[model samples]
Target chain A: EPEVTQTPSHQVTQMGQEVILRCVPISNHLYFYWYRQILGQKVEFLVSFYNNEISEKSEIFDDQFSVERPDGSNFTLKIRSTKLEDSAMYFCASSEALGGYEQYFGPGTRLTVT
Target chain B: DQQVKQNSPSLSVQEGRISILNCDYTNSMFDYFLWYKKYPAEGPTFLISISSIKDKNEDGRFTVFLNKSAKHLSLHIVPSQPGDSAVYFCAAKLGGYGNKLVFGAGTILRVKS
Candidate 1:
């Protein structure tokens, strides 16, 4: 079965540096989302993207965060400046439709900021 | 937070036994519920889901039961096998488009052979 895939499975960056996490969602899926899980914490929603615009975002998705669908298959989350608290496992997900459909998730990129 | 809650931290069941995982939610606006399985170093994999309009949904050995009145749901795995061991997460979402999913702390299951 086709699955969502992410690049740079593990990323290490210095605090205050910019970083980009990339994802290639299931080809035919229309809606894309980004979520993160700090160690020993529940997965938290970051933002949702559709039609090249942000549909929804959480407080954690502040000015420092931005998402882009620069190409047909690539969806990326860029953090303008990384903070120690930003270190987490960032996941990308996509669904064929909203509401009742289940979103498929990628293996996730582990971001570590020091 | 705290919209979704999985009270159990871990569970162990003997092979071929029944395993039940329970979840509770505090948000009534959530109209959809889903269960996901995750292994180490991997992302969550969708297992099954049930809409608020339905009380139950079944697929293979897995059956999801929803009690809308009590704001609770449970996932039952019958004849559990060792391969079924993993961390299970319960998630909820609103009914409309672009709504974010609220996830509970996952419950770890160990199906021993």
Candidate 2:
């Protein structure tokens, strides 16, 4: 079965640095999303992307955060400036239909900010 | 405020026994609910779900029961196996938000053999 794939399984960066997490969703999926999980906390939605634009974003998705589908298969989340609070596991997900099907998740990328 | 909640932090069940996991939510607008399973170092895997219009949904050994009036839901795994040991998360989908889902703190289930 096809699945969403994320790169850089683990990353550690200093405070005030930049980091970009990449994901390749299932080839036929049309909607993509980014979520984060702080240690021992519930998973939180960050942003949703469809048709190359952000459909909706949570308050946690602020100025420092941006998502881009630079090509057909790659979805990326870039953090312009990282902070200690930014340390978390970033997950990427995709769905074949718009709110009609279950979204498949990829193995998350653990981002650690010192 | 937490829209979805799984008050239990962990549960243990013996092999071949039935395991019941419960969840509650404060949001009324949420029309869809789902359950996910996850192991260490991996993202959550879809388990089963139920729409608010229905009271129960079953798939193989997994079943999800939703009580709209009580704002509560439960996931039942029959004849649990060791492989079923993992953290399970309950999530609520806000229909108006269009695919945006709010999740609860996961319940770690240990199915001992």
Candidate 3:
């Protein structure tokens, strides 16, 4: 079965540095999403992307966060300045249809900021 | 406030027995519910899902039961095996154009052989 794939299984960056997490969602998927899980916490939604524009975002997705579909296959989340609290497991997901459809998730990228 | 809640932090069941994992939600607008399984170092994997229109949905050894009136749902694994041990997460989504999903804290299930 085809699955979503994320690059740099783990990322480590300085507190004030910029970092980008990349994902390649299923080829045929039209909707993409980003979620994060702080250690020992529930997974939280960050943002959703469709047609190269953000569909919706959570309060957690603030000014420092941005998402891009720079190419047909790549979806990326960039943090302008990493904070210690930003360290978490970032996951990428995709669904074939919209609205309450089952989403397929990637292995996730563990971001660690010091 | 947590829209979705899994009260049990962990559960252990003997092999070949039935394992039931429970979940509750505070949101009435959530019409779709899903269960996911996760192993260490991996993301949550889709297990099964049920719509409010149906009371139950089953696939092989996995079955999901939803109680819309009670605002609760449960996943039943019959004849559980050691391989079934993992953290199970319950997620809810509002039907229609709503794309955001609210997930519970998760319940760690240990199916001992």
User: Which candidate wins on TM-score?
Assistant: 1
TM match of model 3 to true structure = 0.97
A2-101, model 3: which lDDT tens digit per residue? Answer: 9999989999999999999999999999989999999999999898888889988999999999999999999999999999999999999998764537
Interface RMSD of 3: 1.0
True-vs-predicted CA distance for residue B100, candidate 3, Å? 1.0
Grade the docking of candidate 2. medium
- Which 10-residue window in model 2 chain B sums to the lowest lDDT? B92-101
Model 2, runs deviating above 4 Å = none
For residue A3, what is the lDDT in candidate 3?
Answer: 96
Better of 1 and 2 by TM-score: 1
What is candidate 1's lDDT per residue for A20-108, written digit by digit as tens? 99999999988999999999999999998888899889999999999999999999999999999999999999997534369899999
Residue lDDT tens for model 2, B1-113: 48899999999999999999999999999999999999999999999989999999999999999999999999999989999999999998888644888999999999999
Candidate 2 at A70: error in angstroms?
0.5
Q: For model 2, what is the error of residue B43's alpha carbon versus the real structure, in angstroms, after optimal superposition?
A: 0.1
Residue A104 lDDT (model 2): 84
Quality class of the docking in candidate 3, CAPRI style:
medium
Comparison by lDDT, 1 against 3, better one? 1
